[model samples]
Target chain A: MSWITDEMRGIVGKVMREAVSHPIALSDIRKWAMAVYWPEPLPRQYWDEDYAAQFGGIVAPEDFNPFAWMAAKPTPDDPPVSMSAFRESELGVETPDYKAILLTEIRARHGAPMRPGDVIRCVWKISDYMEREGRMGLMLYTTLS
Target chain B: MGDPRTLAVGDEIPAFSREGTVHHWNRFAAVNYEFAGHHWDDDVARHEGFPAPFAMAPLLHAYLHAMLRQWAGPSARIAAVGIRLRSPFLKGCSMTAGGRITAVRTKAGETVAELELWMDDDTGARLSTGTATVAFPS
Candidate 1:
């Protein structure tokens, strides 16, 4: 039997959650660059506005993630749910008891670069799923976008 | 850095290396809001069947981006990046990420390059494989 139930598969292509971020701060971008490139001098474009004057005054890295700790749209009071699980109960189905979840893959597409004071929004959905046989057992890979 | 004009299929980009440590992971966790015990606690990792706490997946993804931006330069656009994790990047291991150009072409008047990407630790374990597309201005 497949690990994904019919109902679980039904939820695919449905929006799981949405969030709007607080304005992106230059500090947020700088700190992120510092953390990711620890011990290495960061590229001048990230922290040195003088050097980045050509990029229209310091654009955030293409991979920079804006929504980290919190979001403006989903305030702290919002019902907290494991986005990975997305509460199978919501589908009126039994939540599968799983040992773990691994972020097996990541795909990011960049548009115009984000800058200081830019507010970003994200909508997540269960894009697809498949099963694979691995060292431990049959693992289910779920795609979220 | 190779000139974007001279870039061609089969060109290997510079690699980015980092020692897998909680000091780095902790900072990334702080910024990304990733606080899973399996990432910072060896006991938790062992409980989860890993020899030591491992690096976060998103960090590995970001490392690839860092490598790309370094090669393509600031003005270049990182059109898209996709990665597949094969093994965990365990703590104390140093991993290096590198990319090789698979295709180079002109799209919409911009120079576009597609690359195959990979990351391996000091132990030679391949942690992840990926693909990326970068577009440079005409």
Candidate 2:
């Protein structure tokens, strides 16, 4: 059976934009760097106040915006659900019982450098969807921006 | 750091390797609010078809970025990045990130370098592959 129902495909162009609650912070950058095992003798730009002053105060790594804008998990009062999933339910399609939603691909583009205290706004859309066979069974491929 | 102008198409960027650790995974989960069991609980991961808790996709993507930015130095700017996750990177596996300069050109009067980046395990199996574009000062 095809997992890509017309209901799911109907919302392909839907877009959502929101302002993140908190500004990006220096500590967030540091934690991410540490988690990735960023090479030792950590860059002075991330920690040393004197060295960071050269770049208009402490500068985050160039790719740090994603972390800054990550959405917080929804609380019980606010269940997290995607627009496509909602539409699927409306069309009588049951949510799959899969244990994980794997990320098959990602594409990102950089804009302004995000620094400590900079408020971030994220905008994304459902670009496309398709169904294909997988090791388990049918797999759904969805693209977002 | 070598001058961007001196880099050739075949030049090899510096390689970076790190062993995945549970401590690192926990830190990433806390920082990113990624409470997914498959990334932290081995039992849940095994039930989900993974042998062990695996690294999150963004973590692996950031590792690639770290490799590129470290090789290019502090002044470099990454304009774009694209990645395809071919296989799971299990916990405690040693992963090495490296890339080769695929092309260099002047665009909009700025020198740009394109690289094909990848991560491989100690067994030489490719876990992920991607491409990145970085701009250098002229």
Candidate 3:
């Protein structure tokens, strides 16, 4: 799908202007964004590869999908209730049932390539979301959440 | 199989640090579609409460991912990563990414490590701080 439609772009432009003055609360936006971005939890098929790489000697760059994890959302066809079940299956654990939306890092850059004053609008949409159970523990899944 | 017990609590993962500049920031913005004029436009940043155009937040996160891969080598699973933004990352400013292991625990027979991270500017002023958990092999 074309991500840059006139309507979408217009909305993005409006948000850019308003973000400074009428900035949406991060939590609120995150909820909506999470609904689309991280619909549920990390899947076992995906997590297993990622888990193996971290604790075991297995390593593959393709195993990690930070962007996918942050941008995916559930489709209309997905059962909302199934999200929980999907997450538990991915972690392979039962306790703690970790459910958190964490913002982990920020790296400031200097001498940016764009002109020093150009305004850029960032518009993110959710692509998929679900839940999964893995080997680690009870994981409340949300790919981007 | 490598003895799972071989892993120790005091093990230190060497911190990987890198310097970033405006050129890098622009590249990140261009890719991420961060057309915010303040990101690369000096006048706009000043008008918008930033000293200069700053790097994109995602770029910062990507850098952290890179740092993790460098330190943990290829075998590292990022269980969860999060960051809270603080000061502006103005253009012409250089940033350094650093972190240290804070705790380690295993759940479901998996070894997970927690680390505290700091993304700072050239003068050592902190721009962001966060904790991340990752599972690594025994």
Candidate 4:
């Protein structure tokens, strides 16, 4: 039986949205910077009053955009398959048939710089699905926003 | 950061390498709120078929970004970035992140450069591949 069934194909175009309950905090940016070893002088730009003043105030790293949404705690009303849930599923053992799901690719475009106190929002969609033969076996690729 | 005008398509960017540490991973997990067993709990990771706790994919992506941002300089604007994860970067593995300038051109009155980036373990095996575009002052 093909894993890429019509039922699975039907998931294409499905969308989920989420909003950060609070503004992006300076502490959150600092923590992420330190975690990734984002150089010293640059980390200062995220918190230091002097360094950040150059950027019009503390500037969040460009890549930190996605993490802003990740740091947001989910609300009871949020969709079950929201961005947070999708990430948790990728790192958790929730795949169908107990098969492993690997992240093959990721693409992101930077829009606005999220400074301290900026509220964040995220919208993700199931863009496409395909099946292909792989070294391990049949592989199902799902593209999400 | 090097002068963007002087950079050519074949030049190799300065390499950035780091030794993965459990302490660093722990700090990363705490910050990301990622308590996945495979990232911290060795027993669970082994049960899941990994030789040891593996680094999170985002962390590896962050490493590649750091490499790019450092090379691109503070004033340069990163327009886009993409990565393909080839294999898991296990905890405590030493990896180097580097890239080569693939193309350079002027866009919208600004100089832009495209780069092919990659991460390789100490054994020289590629763990991930990536591409990035950055715009600099012409």
**Best candidate, TM-score-wise?**
1
- Order the numbered candidates by TM-score, best leading: 1, 2, 4, 3
Query: Number of clashes in model 4?
Result: 0
lDDT of 1 by residue, A46-99 (tens): 989898998678888777778788778677677465322355564456767766
lDDT of 4 by residue, A1-145 (tens): 5666565555567653444546777888887888787334344665686877765777667767444334364554443443333532322223456345566788878876777888776656668877788756778777887
TM-score per candidate, chains pooled: 0.93, 0.87, 0.49, 0.86
The residue-level lDDT of candidate 4 at B69 comes to: 72
Model 1 lDDT tens row, B2-120? 46789889999998999999998998998888888899997888877789999998889988988998888888889899999999999989999999999989988799999999999
Give the CA lDDT, 0 to 100, for residue A116 in model 4: 83
RMSD of each: 1.9, 3.4, 18.2, 3.5
Best by lDDT: 1
Q: Where does model 4 sit among the CAPRI classes?
A: medium
Residue lDDT tens for model 2, A16-132: 333243667778877766665544656667777787776667766755644332434222223344311223342344545555688888787777777788766665566787778
User: DockQ for each candidate?
Assistant: 0.74, 0.56, 0.08, 0.56
Write candidate 3's Cα lDDT for B36-122 as tens digits. 676677787666555667766666666665566556643445666666666655566677777767777777767777777778887
Q: What Cα-based lDDT does every candidate model obtain? A: 0.85, 0.72, 0.45, 0.72
**Candidate 4 Cα misplacement greater than 4 A, ranges:** A38-42, A65-95, A133-136
List clashing residue pairs in candidate 2. Answer: none
| A8: Cα error in model 1, Å | 1.4
Q: List the candidate 3 regions with Cα displacement exceeding 4 Å.
A: A1-145, B1-12
lDDT by residue (tens digit), candidate 3, A2-25: 212333323321211111112222
The positional error of residue B36 in candidate 2, measured at the CA in angstroms, is: 0.7
